[model samples]
Target chain A: MNSVAQTFSTAALQRNPAWAQLLGLCPLLAVSSTLINAIGLALASTFVVIGSNVCISALRRIIPDAARLPCFVLIIATFTTMTTLVLEAFAYTLYIKIALFVQIIVTNCMILGRAEVFASKQNITATFFDALGTACGFTLALVSLGVVREILAYGTLLAGAHTLFGPTANNWTIQLMDQGLLPLAAYAPGAFLVAGLLFACVRTLRSFKKIPPPKSQSLIQD
Target chain B: MADLALLLIGALLVNNFVLAQFLGLCPFMGITKGYDTALATGIATTFVLSFSALCAHLLYHGILAPLGLEYLRIILFIVVIAGVVQLVKYYLQATSPVLHQLLGIYLPLITSNCAVLGVALLAINANLNTLETLIFSLGASGGFTGVMVLFGAIREVIDHDDVPAAFRGTPLALVTAGLMSLAFMGFQGLAG
Candidate 1:
């Protein structure tokens, strides 16, 4: 039991997919243009990343060295196709906006990177935990950015929640601007600027914690 | 002639491959520190992008889309782009190792560059015929090249110029890109 917890924490502490590693920024920023779009993307990517990790890890040994890239391509394509079909059948409206971006999840650096880096190297159980850790990290970032963009751009949070969460979520909207803040920062430029600023903040905080290495022993040696 | 001009302006300024569309950000930020390097990279990208567009279009229209092979695009494109990069690598090694190294990484990276994939996808999405797809890709690649070189030059100056502490490097480049996107917005009035 302790080992299982240890494994999960190791992924949490040591293998954060979004912040510490900076993987998967494409869909992270692209679909983040709206709250519903962001939620839809987060759910889709989480599904792909977790599913692919498990499948790929299961077949890790069987995959040939010479044909690995193509093999990975084939695997990711199947998963993407499955997700696209599922979304099309049930969530047609949200799926339309996401369009190619959902299929493009196969090309996402973080998802592919994790499959290649961690999942291939670890057992299936550990791989699943690692993928979950990363997906949760990514979902956190996407939700935070979505909240900011939705509030600013539409003067409400979860402005189109019904699109993803269904008709019941029609009441999900939170009016952040009943008083006056229309034309919120939901445009393409705003997304880029916000993402850029977020990246800078993280970089700054990282450098602040960075300890300067001790003086070289060569200089100290007689 | 008017269409060409529209293509040029739209690609070079408006709808920049890097900033506006969010395509090709990997190399845009990675290789734009120096104008000289950026120019070389831009030239190489322009060549590959133009040809990739041409080839990918042919495969899409003449072959894939008709035969119910549209699902095969992502794989087919990677295959063609990788093949082109390999052929270019062979030519460069025999002739100019310096040029090969100059574009060594970005050339291969172009295979998976979302911009390339986005271009092929756009060509199909725009539903252009054979010739139209060719023309569009040429324009798109040209625009990609133009903006790449221009952004590269602007970044060079920014690197030397006094920049704010908070917005020193990537932050400053992105802010510059945002301003440039606004500049490009001025040209959106042109006919496609």
Candidate 2:
């Protein structure tokens, strides 16, 4: 029980998939221009990561070492496909906007990294908690970026909530300003700049107190 | 001919895979510390991307679409890409052992690069024919290589500059990339 709790905290804070590990930046940076889109992608990725982690952990004993990567990728791809179908069915508008990124989640090093580094060796219970923590950490990163970018780009929060939440959410959007303060924040270049500044902020906060070295170096690698 | 040239230039500059479209960022940030290694990875990636795009186009239109197995594309495309990377590895091993050694880990790492898959998927999504798919992949990979080399050069210079502790490595690199991306955005008018 204690070990499980520790694994959850470590994955969530010390080794966040997006901010620290930098495993899944493709989707992280691409779809974060709007809060709703970010939330949608976050939910889909969480489902895939946790689903793949649990499945991989349960089948670890049988998967061959030489073929483990293909196996892990296959599992991740299956879950990603399921996610695609689910989104297309329930939130067709949102699905079309992020279809490419959603499909490429299979190649996301974050999911594959967890499978190779933690899931393949740990028991199912521990793997579940680890996946939960990583998913939460990833969600936090995505939502924060989403909030920042959305406010800067559109001057609105949850601008298109109706796409994800159906007709009822048509009014969920909160207009923060008459016009976006920085229209550049909606463009491709803005993503890199905002992400760079965010990283610097995180570093500044961490510098005040010493933290242990990351348990693994660069989880973005396959 | 003019349309093809436009597509090429558009993919190369206006819609660059890394700077503009945000694909293949893992390698963009990871393997870009040195110019030589970055160029090698870019070349290998270009080779894999063009070939895989060709293969994916054929497989999708020839097999999957005909059989109504389009939903299986994500899985199939990834598997095919992994196989293509392996084939590239062996071909390089037999032909150019020195180059193979230079790109040791990054060669296999290409299997997971989203840009390769992104090109393939984007080709199908845009309904490009075989020739167009090939051209687009080449252009996209070309853009990828160019930006990588440029970023590599920038990082080399950045290493010598005085930098604060909080923004030394990735943060600093990202800011440089943002500036580069801003520069690339200038080409937007050239394409359209």
Each candidate's interface RMSD (Å, one decimal) is 7.8, 2.0
Evaluate every candidate with DockQ and list the scores.
0.33, 0.70
TM-score of chain B of each: 0.85, 0.98
| Share of native C-alpha contacts between chains A and B (below 8 angstroms) recovered by candidate 2 | 0.76
Candidate of highest lDDT = 2
lDDT of 1 by residue, B94-117 (tens): 999988878776676565556666
Whole-model Cα lDDT of every candidate shown, in order: 0.70, 0.91
Error of 2 at B177 (Å): 0.7
B99 Cα displacement, candidate 1 (Å): 2.6
Q: Per-prediction TM-score, please? A: 0.85, 0.97
Give all candidate RMSDs, comma-separated.
5.5, 1.4
Model 1, residue A95: distance off in Å is 2.4
Model 2: residues with Cα > 4 Å off, grouped in runs? A215-222
lDDT of 1: 0.70
The residue-level lDDT of candidate 2 at A50 comes to 99
